[model samples]
Target chain A: MTYVSPPPEARSRGWYKRNEIAVTPFLFLIPAVLFFAIYVIIPIGQSFWISFHEWDGLGDKTWVGTANYERLLFDDRKFTTSFWNNIKWLVLYLLAIPGGLFIALFLNQTVTGIRLYKSLFFFPFVISQVVVGLVFSWFYLPREGLLNAILAVFGAGPVNILGDPSTATYGIIAAGLWPQTAYCMILYLTGLNAVDPEQVEAARLDGAKGWRMLWYVILPQLRPATFIAFVVTIIGALRSFDLISVMTNGGPFGSTRVLSFYMFEESLSEFGFRMGYGAAIAVVLFFIMLGFIVYFLWSMWRDEKGAR
Target chain B: MQSIFKASVAALALGAVAAPAFAESHTLSGDLRIISDMSNPAPRAVMEGLAADFGAMHPELNVELTIVDREAWKTQIRNALGANPPDVVNWYAANRMAPYVSAGLFEDITDMYENGDLTGLDSVKGALTIDGRQWGVPYTYYQWGVYYREDIFNELGLTEPTTFDEEIANCQVILDSGRKCYTIGTKFLWTAGGWFDYMNMRTNGFDFHMQLARGEVEWTDPRVRETFANWRKLIDMGAFIDDHQSYSWQEALNFMIDGEAAAYLMGNFAVAPLREAGLSDDQIDFYQFPMIADVPQGEDAPTDTFHIPSGAENKEAARAFLQFVTSPDVQTEINSGDGLGQLPVNANSGVDADEFLEQGFEMLTTNAEGGVAQFFDRDFPAEMASVGMEGLQEFMVFPDNLDDILERLEDARQRIYE
Candidate 1:
């Protein structure tokens, strides 16, 4: 390919032409960048802007700067309940990662119909969260549920898991964990397949086995899978709206509200749209997520730099 | 389907509105586009029939009807009303319409009431009014009351009580018989609000209840506390089903159906379901939520309405459509047992001959002496209602938390109304 740059007109736009190799990637990125800016970044800015005003979604915006936040931070009991429930969700949801790893290790071995076993273990993840919520809600039904039937078989009394405010959030988290654990198990299973067997054999030869081997040799090799799992699990815990919506609609007296569900309840729910207050809630959620995001990015950067 | 049919019919039969529907003598032209949320098969059919009938009447006019999913229409309503709205759309009455009314998204149809054709609309004028002006007109509503298992009452040798003392005595007897007196699901919170509505209205009268709904009264007001105390009487009696907070209102029906719960303090909608569940007409019956106080009885009846958006291009035709809907004949046809299965807003409209409808219609039109509330969630502002219902549910569960719950609701009422 001969470069035809003899045209004087082309020279005037020479910078781009000369740097086309470097600039072409950015030019190619234009569409994705524009989409992200419009759908993601702009909306985020809009949310922040809305957080400063009192808007009923349709009516004129009344600038009541910081009032929403002040009420949320100090006066709102429901907000306090939602924030604490989110904490419960985050802390409990991490159990899925460890739970997934255990199941992954147990299932990684050769067995009769191992493929069937693997898929069976992964089945929960395949179902939609809404389905999971519905199934769990039915299971928690005091009289007509399989859970109570099983409890009866054991001569134990029925427990209304979803009815009691004290236990409702935990019940939903447990339901959420069912599918999340499956998701993490799949991640770990793939990670295990990529494990260096020679390295594992060497570690075994040195008397490393069970928990010791899992902690030092096997885990170190599974860093990328673990990282991805951690990221998804954290985000899943934060944005745990569907299961809450389907399972409880943040009810049994709203004992199961997390930030995401509460935001929907305030902003776009049939109740009424307090878009500004919802945005303020969203803003708080964003900051919380931003903290974890910055940490994850920093860790990824550190890893990349070390590799370099 | 049978339950909705029966429930709505019973509700209509019980309605007391006696407004005379005047025929529209004027003719209208141009496109009358209507987007209705009557997406349920039965209501959808009724809405289509109304549109078709009206279109047939106005041969020179084009009637375009769009039936949207009831749930989906909720979020889309604002956007639809904001930009290029249809000529008329389906919406709920009361505070549900308040936001649209204040924003002027809805047409100020106060002048429509001045039209003699809509003279019958005066009775339900409150439901569709905001800021001392009418914004729309109600098409249908159903009565809320106790639908008890007459079989259970018969088995227990009991009768429907008419006063608070008798109510307690009957509940005690029902409880002693190893059955719950009431089967309520507070899972969604609104069911508890219904209980609160009856208790509060019965205890404090309808006007006081409305004042509380309007946030004119504080939650911690002694009168409000008295309402709670009255509700606590039933809660403490364990009258409601066990573990009710877990069940939806639909799911709670199992107890009533199975005879484990003696009654349901519900809208007339429960009648159809009771009949479907194999209860004979004699096995189930309607009653005013047995009067709890000396005050006049008030009832909760959430009215579904139709409105013309201000952005409508065919205001003249839309106005005609509104008039047509509120007219007595259309109201009777639409509210018939096979149509919407509910009461026509027009008091002059004759209801179906269904037993529950006869009782419900009689109750609402006559026995509902104090006032007709648009249910708790409807009458109260949305945010306040949401918070209030939650507090009410909490109170039902933990009666000792009354102080805390009242304080919290008082806070919400202050913030919400302000």
Candidate 2:
């Protein structure tokens, strides 16, 4: 049947006009927009405003421009230590990306009940951070804990893993990696599923095996998964608080104190509610996070532009 | 389409009807939220029972309770007190309450005192009173003392040490027996400070501690130095647990219970855990730390009280709850628990009334009679406590820098006062 095309204005008036279809997506997104505005956008703005003032959570707030920041920069030892430790955490925590890929490749076989083994490996990640901290702390207990018990069997002297300042932060970080590596492994496993079988067979035919296969063929295919794993690991390391709280409470002379725990300690702890000072610490932390976030976003943007 | 729209409208109407019913109850509407600093399950059970009783009595007031950890509790109380404090909640005594009271954060229960709603508040009245007006009602108070395992003492055939020399001898005996003399944890680090407080209280008395708290005396004063010297003597005699940096209060208790350690220099709160371990009252005993020959006596007890926040929603209800808590009946119930054998603030309530509280009462009352000092943290401002705790931790970890440590503390004190 021959049909005449309607004019633009008439099409706009029609039910399934371009304008109607275009507006439909935004209509469906109203609830999400409202939620994001209420919970995320507003709070970030409020926190930034509060960062500039000297206000306890309750009483009258006094405007003190840049004083909190000054204290955070020059006065607060806890803040400095925590920030430096966060740097260490970020650097060390990214090790999980490669480690996860290694484990995923090892366990990605189509053997019988390999699924059960994968789930079991992922079990630590499934448990709460609080439980992981508790389990690790008990494991590291010097006198009667599982670690000490194991050491005793070997006739080795007991190590106070959590108590010793040298090992405490690293010990907690190791516990964090237990779940983090599992998470990365799951991401890689999904990425591995979409790998080109024909290319793998061709590579095998060309005598590319093991390390050569992984470096030239497999890892390149898992680029998206690796990036996600690295991003999450970095964020997890920077924001580690629960395990430290549960395990050490920044004890043994505040040696294990991190930015998040230190911020909490400074603001609302028995040390006194120096809320302004706390905000300054938070601002420093936010900037540090912003730096990482900006780099990641810039890289993504560059990749998108290059693709176009 | 019409039928679906009608059903949707009916469902929306029903949801609107149900929303108000969720909040509107025959039972009390708002939860009578009580934020306690006591997070341990031992006291939690007692508080829960008390809450249940309180709820049953006043059906209109629903009591929802939470026990915040100590550090969080302090911060939360500070935050809550300024704008929207709990109607009633726990607070520390004396110097600790001064800042809150000065800020007008706590409600004055002066009426309770005048009307005789609080009968024996006059006795421990100094505890909750800020600026000569009552800000809180005392719930529990306990003396700081050496909590020794009577079993260990019996095993070594040694008696409780009454004098400084004898205390050293007791440590000597324990060391001779191949067991450590004391069980302590410097991991959380405050347990070490308890020793310093008690020693300072015994060596220097209340006036000296008050001076220290006020930033009047140098932290490097000879009196403070002498207290450290005494602590060093115990250290020299090998009177403390090995690897003390590895444990918390409960972990230290485990050492004492297991017979790896002889004594735990702690407050009466230690009794509850010992009791929980099935150790009878006779298995554990308390004694004041030995006196330095020249130092005047000072009280070394800590007191916990309830203060009304400045912006309490239910002022009358909060006041009534505070008054009720300090009443003899409720105080007696608190003392009945092994975890809270803290002396009752109401002196007239008498120790003989509650079998459990009698021992703690005798200790606190005796210290009060002898002119003892307040516990260290209670006597000092929060700023000072922070520095003092750090100093104590440093002293334990590095005993040789006694002079340097004192100087550092003095610097901290100067900074805080400034």
Candidate 3:
């Protein structure tokens, strides 16, 4: 740090003037730091604290030690089902990345009305997730859905996609993917624009083409976009609450409950008042997310060092 | 013209509210904040009217009415009451209030009840009281029963069933006639809870039904099984509409409207919407759910109530507001055909002359010999009800899974009650 000598006007201002340069940046940082501590850091700490209690949200919180966590891990079938559903969501949701890349590649063309085609493909992301859930809810309707309508033309089903426990989770994920894939496609489209055509041409001259060209040259350049897509997808899968809430309400007998939705159902929803259990669920979800967060920070750090 | 008519109605209602207030010995002169859950079009009007008239009665008192959506208020009430508590709030009766009452969020209004300040409320006082002390006052309640197609019944030459055999015979006839006997949607799941309330009550009588609700009885108790056995008979007969799990209670009404189903076991609120949906009074009629055994005939009548938070700033005004709202005249006016179109909790108040309301009032007053129960979800603890309703829905869909469902509920009951 550089030492700043007191100016003539500040010479008689004591230690305050002597330390102005050193303290000015901290004064500027206080607002953001305060907000972050209050909103994010403090709540994370509070969640961990609350998890060890038996609170019904209205009453005084009773410290139950690790009982909430024990019940959540061992005895609660709903939690088990929700955890498995989260796994299903995580694995299935990653399909969007590849799906987006293919669509981005297909749309990376010089044709008439290509922009129109791209926008049409990008249309789902423009609308809200709630709308997507509703449209897909009707699409999977047992008797009068578009899915059944199309299937009937081929002498097949009247399948109740959202009604059956076995297929309801898949149906919701498919709806979520509609918009999520669009998001990834846009990310990749921007990445493809800055994809360094000179490198692509150089690879083509070396006889690299098609899938090989994509793997060796295109994908390497789209690393930033892929990185963003992977992180967002993971977070989206972990926080898969809204679509499930809007569509099934974690139902046909709690078959579609993920951890985020389950936490809400156990704490704040009409029947839920077990706040300690909910906080325990939240703490578990936070730890799960923390693993990815640490990985992201480490990767960023490595990348920064490489740049240096 | 519409605005003019609305103004006249408002003036008339406000006039009624104002007349009694002039008799109050002292004037209230502080901000009285209220959080109401009467967010429906008709109920919202009644709430706003109540707040306005209260403000009018106490000219110096600033009355604030914040109307939250009825469903959202269920979860929001705890936060609302636990924090900067309002002077008054809307909530449901029975175990639905247990959380707030036990948490000391609600004011104990027992002295008001004992002092004879709220007259003719003793009949529903049982609902407002927990541990021998009154906590709140009920403004309105509605009866739940089989709302059948009178036109269909007449066409098929069938009478309202009065016993288990007769009900089964009637349902078989309806099914044979190429229509379902009942339309129910377990999508939101409480509609199924209503069915369970009636079935369990009628089979084992109200006391045992209440014991089951209180978690004192096992889900696998043979007597509880007896109730399910009766429920299973109907399921096995395909007596309910197909894909009932997909529709909501409101959506299920389409079956009756289209003559695809013959009846719906629902609350009195369904009457208003049925009329709105183009079903005339002649097309629909009410009947209590038929007897499944020789038990006293219990009925499901869920009461909606109001309470003052414990930390209310203007409690004097809040107590006066509760008394004013539950007054016989006010109850009669608010529960009129033009208002909530339901039964008034003030026993002295006459119900609206609406046909369905009259029938429901009669049924709940004289015919409910076993007891009047707050519907299942309201009677049982909230956690148990949530898990229980889901199991009930699953049971309706898969009758063979009864053992598994019962085991799950028994486990939940043990854990929750402990």
Candidate 4:
């Protein structure tokens, strides 16, 4: 009576119920895993497959082995230009982080209507990139734009910012940095808000102040925000397409083209769909991004292990 | 129930016997989809109105029109015509439609031409024909020429240029007067093709331009270099507005309208924007791009066309829509509408009362003594055109690099055409 054995099915069901702790988390992960595979993982594999073939978006696919990659590496000058521009974008876009930190520090105080001031400072991040691009294009307009007008006031003649090959990419990058800087500012602002007051007081007691106090005391606490800002800024810079598209359209003889815009122009432009070549470009970009992702994951893993 | 069944069978047999005789008058009913690049408000509204009118005439048919932005439509059209194809789609005549035709994405609509008056559509019909069969029905076409400021000319006491030398002299006069001779926007790349079309056609004439666009001639050929040489003369004369690469065609018009530039080489569609900017017919006028090398003037009059997709679910309904689109009444309505500002392809469709329209027609028919050439980008394969236009843009930006640009274009041509 105390321990009567149940039927085999009922006994197995009880065993399953007892092991729910081991299985429930995986069950919860199924939906996310499925979506990730469908949207991200599957497309990446398909892009790799497409890179081996010469296919217009509409017609039959013909396998051409590594011809697309060969063309990209050796034959295509536009590809080289785009790769260089992407590198430049990656390097220059990092300025947003310190720029944001400067602004966040300037507005970190709790004065009256400080909330309004913070929102105003964060306004650029809220506007659409397309609108930002248009604003920047108009800003750089050769004769009548704001930049030219401002120059004229100082007895300096107008300079074409977006029309010249030398300056066009920088002009677009400057546009991208406006919103990126605002984004970094908000992240830093939140990080600053979470800073421990007791630590600041302790540092003050030790006569630490200004650069010394901030570097020795505050920066260590802001690491998490800095990590996130760095990750996003890198991704943002790498995917800089909308601004270039709207502002210069990779013009001034295709000098402003980044990898993303070039890929689009190659495969989906009025130039006729070179799906194979576009896929090859995408594959190259994927590997470059994968390198960053692996480093990021490895670093994060190390940090987690250290924290434990 | 049995008696009723027998009666129905008898009725069916009788209906089948008479079906053939009544087939010509049968009303077609289905959803017709037309994907068009009429994103501008005026053309979009005009197309919408025409669709509504067509729908009204055939109550059984439903017309679903999708008007997409021009640049977006270029990409989307491939998908639209490649898979789940629309019943009808808008495209340019001649070489622009050639790829789709070769891909068998568009239907053979030669029968539609036989059913309509083909007189007025002779030029465009020739353009839309491939393998001696018509593939599309052109609805509208407009001439491209130098739209100049009449008031500026009168003020400077400068006469209209008739020869290449006179045009160059005119440019000098404008330059001396501290004004630019032309304003062109090369940002979209295709705008540069307009200048190339004018230069090539003026230098070597129509046949050569067509051959070059078709990739039959080497881009590095001496004759081609001469065309570039002539264009270099214009560039060296300071003919164009500064920083043209940053502006779109619409943006470049600002210079022309603001009196900073004296003229623009553009299609008739530009007239609406110019008019909107407060220029009247009296203030502005059209002139053929002047003669160069004494070759026949091969004018660029790009024709807008519509065609049924091969994968259309309802061919009959699509054909009806095409017929409606090309009908003189509908053509007249479209041309007269404020949006298109183009001439109708139907000969019976009377010309608009507007002076510019009248003059454009006269110049295209009587003055363009050589023949009509589709715009450079339209007349060439998209891949070749893209490379060609890029070379043209590079030349415009750095004329000293003409040889390098030409060589690069030649490389692309051999690769693409191979």
Candidate 5:
């Protein structure tokens, strides 16, 4: 192979001059940066500050000095329930990733109208969560809903999907899973597009098949998609508020309250804004989220070092 | 160059001087966004008429009224106040205003109140006042009562019950006739609490209700237990609808509107919805809950009030609007806005409507005469309402667990008070 060097004029130039970058990129970045700071960063910092004080969002903020944190630890049952529910949500929600992968694989073939089938499978994720909550609520309605109607065919009585304390949260989580699983499927489909056909053929020749082949070969290649799916699912589980609000409003005796709903209930709902208490709940949630973020960053750093 | 500099300096001085004066002399000329949960025709008509009247009174201010559904309004009010609060907005009385007042989020209307700028000041000023400072004015007053169907009662040969037992007997008669006695929705859960509040108030009077609301009285207090016992009797008799847990208040109203349900124990605000469905006043009647008849008199019956946001740009204009609303003429105009026939805040305004409103007016005035107390939600605080509503709902469904429910409510109260 022959190698050619750059012209002397190009080689002579410094890094800044060679780039010739315009201000347009900075212009494009400005709006996004501004939005991020305004909506995300500032509110986060404000919530953290609020966690330290007793505020109702209206009155003079009393300097509570971690009193809220203390109360959340010892006094607030809703906080404990909300935190535990979030954990349940995170653990069960991850099932969507694998469920989505299976569906994607099954529908990956280039058959007639496979695209339409894929889209149809993805339709739940396309709708807003509010609509999904309404649909699921109707589906789970005690006597008149689809689930009950189906149960009636089997000669079973109506199930109180949203009324019973034990099953209400689980039912809502199931509703959440429907859309989340579809989202994971989309991610896997994209990842499968770039899979090496040659490698798969060689693996098949070597007698690797089904679960074993998938575990060793295809799964490893799909790690990036899986990672993204896990990350979003975790965040979704932690911030699960809208669906719970729409589906049940933490009802049937606060059985469905997640951390986000609990926080809002304390600070904003008919429950007078104990902003400090709400912030304390937020602080606890923040630490939990931070653990995952730190682990993710550390893993990335370790991978970079290994590559070097 | 000297002349040019002088001219520029003079123009700058004139601009500075003219700006505030221009702002002051102008009538409410810009957008007056009024955010309310008053979506029904009666309040909406009144609100629209107020805009027209205000426009006629002062042409500069253009009122832009935006009515949100009840739940949506709470979220909107918080966001709006946190960012850009409207000039005039709707709010509840007492502790509801306390949060906003303490934070300096509302304009102080003490000056206007003291100056007699708002007529009928004695009637509504209390609702808007916190710690002696006036915050907002009430456009209308409402009474909580049992709205029953006169046609059904007459058809069944029943008179309005005078005592708690009589009320129970009345329900029994309706039930024996294979009719559902009462309608309620526990879907949002608070609707159940309203029933509990009325029962407790009637059984133990305002002081006990206040004590319970404040968490001073245990939910299992004998008085409180009595309220539950009373509720249990009704529940045992199947007084309420079968599937109330799944119904919203509006959905329950559908039962009354269609004559499927005989009675609704609800606030006076409910009348407009019933009337809108083409039900005549002759078909509907109101009465105080029979529970309170045995108890001693209490302070002022609770009232819903509104406030001026602190960050409002048109503070003076808002003050003027509040004053105008409380005036006798405007109060009458507001009452007649859409046949809402709400009890006027002005004690002197007196009821001049058909019999339903007249009876409501008489009850409210008698309450005013007796004295007033903040409603349970307002008196106790928000945290209390949360656990309280839950306990009420639980008790409604599981009367056997009254002790456990009351104990939980007490625990919630203890934490909140601490």
Candidate 6:
């Protein structure tokens, strides 16, 4: 190859190209940033803006200045019910993580048709949550449902699970947990595959066995999966709208309502679209979710620093 | 083809001499979009066929009809009407359309009626009128009545109850015979409103019911309390099925169909489901809700309406389509036979020979002088209706909480109306 030493412009172009690395990443990121801004970020800001106004969606917005928040916090009984229901959902929904870990551990061993067993275990998560909700709703039907039929055989229940105000939220949450548990199981299964076999062998040689071996060694290795499962399950619980919508529509006198469903109902024009009020509800929900997200980021950052 | 060619040549010659007249009769060409909630198989098929028939009649016009699921339609309608609205939209007749109309989301097509292009909708015109102006053209409505199992009634030596006492006694007898007197499902919430409407209208009379629906009367009014008290009687007698709140309206009908429950207070649309459940015509029967205190017997006949959105781009085409839909022929086709099984609003529309429809027509026409209510949910503002229906459901589950429920409903009513 001949060296073209006389080309000064080419040498300068090389300098510019060396600096282009930083700009190239940003250029590649622009499409995603634009989409995220348009679909997610801007709507969030708009919801915050709408929360301060009294607008019926189609009409001119009147600035009401914290009136919606005041009503939500003080006046609305439905809002209070929905807020408590959301808390109940969050608390109950956390059970999926451990339940999933147990299932993943049970199915992690190699055996005949192990792959088929794993796939079948993941089946509920594969279907849409809407479908899961519908199936669970049919299963919980007071008279003609599978659960009631089984209960009838034992002379126990013709219990109206989704009908009674006391049990409706728990019933929906249980339905939600089915798919959520499957999702966690899949996450843990992948995490288990990536576990270092050498570490397990070393721990076994040290006389560690069963629960202690798994808890101290295996679980520590699966931190990333556990973190992901926690984040997703928390978000899943907070944003549970479709299941409640499909199952009860926040019925049996609005006993099963969660915050998301309440926000939707408030802003639905069919229910007279109190847009400002709905936006207020959304802002409260956003703050709640933000608390979890911030906590997650803080913990992740701490873990990252500790690892380094 | 030859006749068409000859007619075109003659039309071309005549168009030159009478350009204005030709233009007047010429179908305006544009995309006329209609959004409907006729999502059920029978109604959806009828609506689609009607759109095709209308498109055939007007060759220049391109009709686009979007049928959406009923629940989805409720959330979608605001966006559908607020932004780039479809030319025509289907909605409930009265109070349900009021919010849209007040927000100027719907166009005033009163001219269509005055211009003689639309006629013979006197029965339902009142529902579409607000503040001395017509806002929509109603196409279909159905009667709400007590549908009972005739075989069960015959076996119990019972007849149709005409008075409140007789009805309570009949319910007592049905309970004694180990059957539910009424079956209702409140899982969707609106089903409870049907019971409330009949009780209110029967006790307080139609005018008071309308006033209450409009929020002119407080929910805690003595008359309103009486309505709840009467409803309490049914609950006390164990008239309704156990675990009524767990089922949808369709699922609740299973109790009636299986002979566990004797009667259901529902619309005429429920007949198809009953028949599909294998009930023969003779096995089913209808009766007006029993009189409570000798007040004029009002009937709930919720009418379905169509209106042109104010933001619609093709108003002329939309108006023409509305007129086409309300024509006697189209009305007859939509209302009669196995389509929607609803009553045609147009007086000139041909009647169906179905016994249930005949009974509904007779009952509705006779009670016409008293007034025809557009059920509780339809007659009240959406916000008020939501709150009111919630209260009704709460009452169903806890009849002893009537006082608190009414107070809460009054609070919601004041908040909404103000």
> Each predicted complex: what DockQ?
0.73, 0.33, 0.74, 0.68, 0.33, 0.62
Clashing pairs in 2: B105-B310, B298-B372, B298-B373, B299-B372, B299-B373
By DockQ, who's the top model here?
Answer: 3
Q: Model 6, which residues run further than 4 Å from truth?
A: A1-22, B1-31
lDDT of 3 by residue, B1-418 (tens): 2343344445565575445643378888889999999999999998898888778778889999899989888878877887789999999899999988898889999998988789999889999989999899999999999999999999999999999799899999999999999999889999999999989999999999999988899998999999999999999999999888888889899899999999999999999888999999999999989988899999999999999999999999999999988987778778888889999898877777788888899999899989999988889999999999999999998889899999999999998898
Q: Please, what is the whole-model Cα lDDT of each candidate in the order they appear?
A: 0.87, 0.76, 0.90, 0.86, 0.76, 0.87
lDDT of 3 by residue, A84-146 (tens): 999899999999999999999999999999999999999999998899989999998888789
TM-score against truth, every candidate:
0.94, 0.85, 0.94, 0.92, 0.84, 0.91
Clashes of each: 14, 5, 0, 0, 15, 0
Candidate scoring better on lDDT of 1 and 2: 1
Q: Can you write out model 6's per-residue Cα lDDT over A71-122, one digit (the tens) per residue?
A: 8999989999999999999999999999999999999998999999999999
lDDT: which is higher, 4 or 6? 6
The TM-score obtained by model 1 is: 0.94
Highest-lDDT candidate:
3
- Cα lDDT tens digits for candidate 4, B56-120: 66668788888899878877787788768888888888888877888899899887678653445
Ranking, DockQ, top scorer first: 3, 1, 4, 6, 5, 2
Which residue runs of candidate 2 sit more than 4 Å off their true CA positions?
A1-34, A270-272, B1-87, B114-117, B220-223, B310-321, B328-334, B337-340, B353-359, B368-374, B400-412
Instruction: Assign candidate 1 its CAPRI class.
Output: medium
Report the Cα lDDT for residue A236, model 3: 82
Docking category for candidate 5? acceptable
Cα-based RMSD of the predictions, in order?
4.4, 11.0, 3.7, 8.0, 9.9, 6.0
Candidate 6 residue-wise lDDT, B57-89, digit = tens = 667889999999987787788889877789998
Better of 1 and 6 by DockQ: 1
Query: By descending lDDT, how would the candidates be arranged?
Result: 3, 1, 6, 4, 5, 2
i-RMS, each model, one decimal: 1.2, 2.3, 0.8, 1.3, 2.1, 1.8
lDDT (10s digit) by residue, model 1, range B1-418: 3454455445545432222222235567888999999998889999998887677677788999999999899889988998789999999999888888888899998888875658676779988888899899899989888888898888888888899899999999999999999998878888998999999999999999999988899999999999888888888999888887777888899899999998898887777667788888888888888777788889898999999999999998898789878877668769887887788788767777777777778888788889999988888888998888888888888899999989988888777778
Candidate 4 structure quality by residue, lDDT tens digits, A207-290: 999999979999899999899899999999999999998998888888999999999988887775889989999999999999
Worst 10 residues of 3 chain A by lDDT: A5-14
